[model samples]
Target: MLNALLFDLDGTLTDTDALHLLALQQLLQEEEGRVFSEAEFTTHVSGQANANMCRYLFPERSLVHHEAFAERKEQRFRQLSPQLQPMPGLLRLLDFAQEHGIAVCVVTNAPRANAEHMLRVLGLSQRFACVLVAEELPRAKPDPLPYLSGLECLGARADEALAFEDSVPGLTAAVGAGICTFGLSTSQPPQTLLDAGAHRVIEDFNDPQLWAEIHRRLDVR
Candidate 1:
């Protein structure tokens, strides 16, 4: 039987990818006089941790530089948190899960502060049973550690859990953990997400396919 739902934070629960892109554009341009386009942002920045992104984008820069840029970028993101919007039908899904006695967990590669800010902004700070931060783990997304930890926390088996993500890394992590991963088409394109190992691509929580799967999973109980 289906036992739990694990979700990604940033692009999955709320619509904040645009804010991240804007922050990146302004910061990158002001700090390095480089033009950061949407395509580049989606490819290199989305689904990645701050330090990892900085290292990948600026390998020559010192650790201090990476830390500073990550701090500044995160501060800017918090400033834009007030504009965050929860995914449509998200409340309905949560209510359904609660009524069905299914566990829910949030698994993300976002920094702790950023994750807290986003959940608070969405008024979902107290919703989940557990919040797993990839940064707090020895290995981040694409390593399966975080998602596996989430399942362990919820006492749910991989075959009994459903994971939702909007980025390649998050989806890869969940799928690698042996969970059925659904990709949200919010930041990355659908095909891009599928190529990363997502079993299904959904527009949002309101997606018909998502609801169908929800029913199929719970009806067995």
Candidate 2:
């Protein structure tokens, strides 16, 4: 049975990846006169945890510096996010889960502030039963601790839950946690997501393929 729904906040619920990239780009340009191309972002940056991302982008920087830079990037992204909206069919999917008595939660690698800001911007602050942030846990995505913790909070088994993710780390983490994971191609390439262990990839929640799978899993009419 489909007992829980796990969602990765940024790109899975909404197309906020571009804004995140823009925030990082603006900060990098201001600090180092560098431009971050999309290919570089998709390959080397997207879905990474704040500490890892900052270290990768500024390897010479100290942990304190990385933390500060992450804060700045998140603040800029929030400022750029007032126009955010839910992904197409997302509300409908949430409704389905609600109707079926399926528990819903958000598990993200984003910092707590960023996650809260984004969810509030999308009017979803009160939606999830649990919101798990990587920084609050012992380990972040690509390690499964976050997702495993999410399952614990929901009192759901990994095989009985479904996860929606838009990036490699998110997908890898959920799959590693033993949840059946579906990839939302909101930011990364579908094939890359599949390669990262996504059961299937879709452009958005509205994809017919996603609905078919959900129906097959839940055995609902």
Candidate 3:
């Protein structure tokens, strides 16, 4: 039986990817005189940890500089939070989880500020049992530590939890931790997510097939 629902915050729970992309594009232009294309953002920036993204995008910069850049980028993102929208069926899924007594946890590669801001904007600040930010963990997404930690925090085994993700790194983390993972398809192609080990790909929580799979999993349990 699924005892917990582990979710990725930015793109999975809320449609913040486009906002983030814009922030990154603006940041890159201001800081490095570079332009960040949407395809590049999807392929390189989305789903990556702040530190990793910084290193990848500005290898010549010092760690301190990268940290500052990340902070600025996130600040820009938060400024655009007013435009945030919850992923379709998010509230219904939360209600279902609540009615069924399933624990809901937010597991994200996002910084704590961004995570908190997004949740608050979606009016979901108090809905989750726990919110695990990657920076606070020993390792971030694509490493599985964050997802493993979320499962441990919920006192749920990987087999007893379902994870929702919207990026390759997030999928890798959740799947690596042994959780049944679903891709949100908000940030990457469905095939990319499937190749990254997602059990299924969904446009949002409203996908009937997602509910069907959930019912099937529950029936077996």
Q: Put down candidate 2 lDDT per residue, 1-221, tens digits, no spaces.
A: 88999999988998887898899899999998998988888877788899889878989979998888889998999889877899999999999888889999999999999888888888888989999999899999989999999999999999999999999999989999999999998888788999999998988888998889889888877
lDDT of 3 by residue, 70-150 (tens): 999999988977757788999999999998889999999999988888888889999999999999988999899999999
By summed lDDT, the worst window of 10 consecutive residues in model 2 runs over: 37-46
By TM-score, how accurate is candidate 1? 0.96
RMSD from true fold, candidate 3? 1.4
For candidate 3, the per-residue lDDT at 83 reads 56
| lDDT (C-alpha, whole model) for all candidates | 0.90, 0.90, 0.91
- For candidate 1, write residues 105-206 as lDDT tens digits: 999988889988888878999999989988899999988999999999999999999999999988889999999999999998899999999989999898
TM-score of 2: 0.97
- lDDT score, residue 73, model 2? 90
TM-score of each: 0.96, 0.97, 0.97
Each candidate: RMSD to true structure?
Answer: 1.3, 0.9, 1.4
Clash count, one per candidate: 0, 0, 0
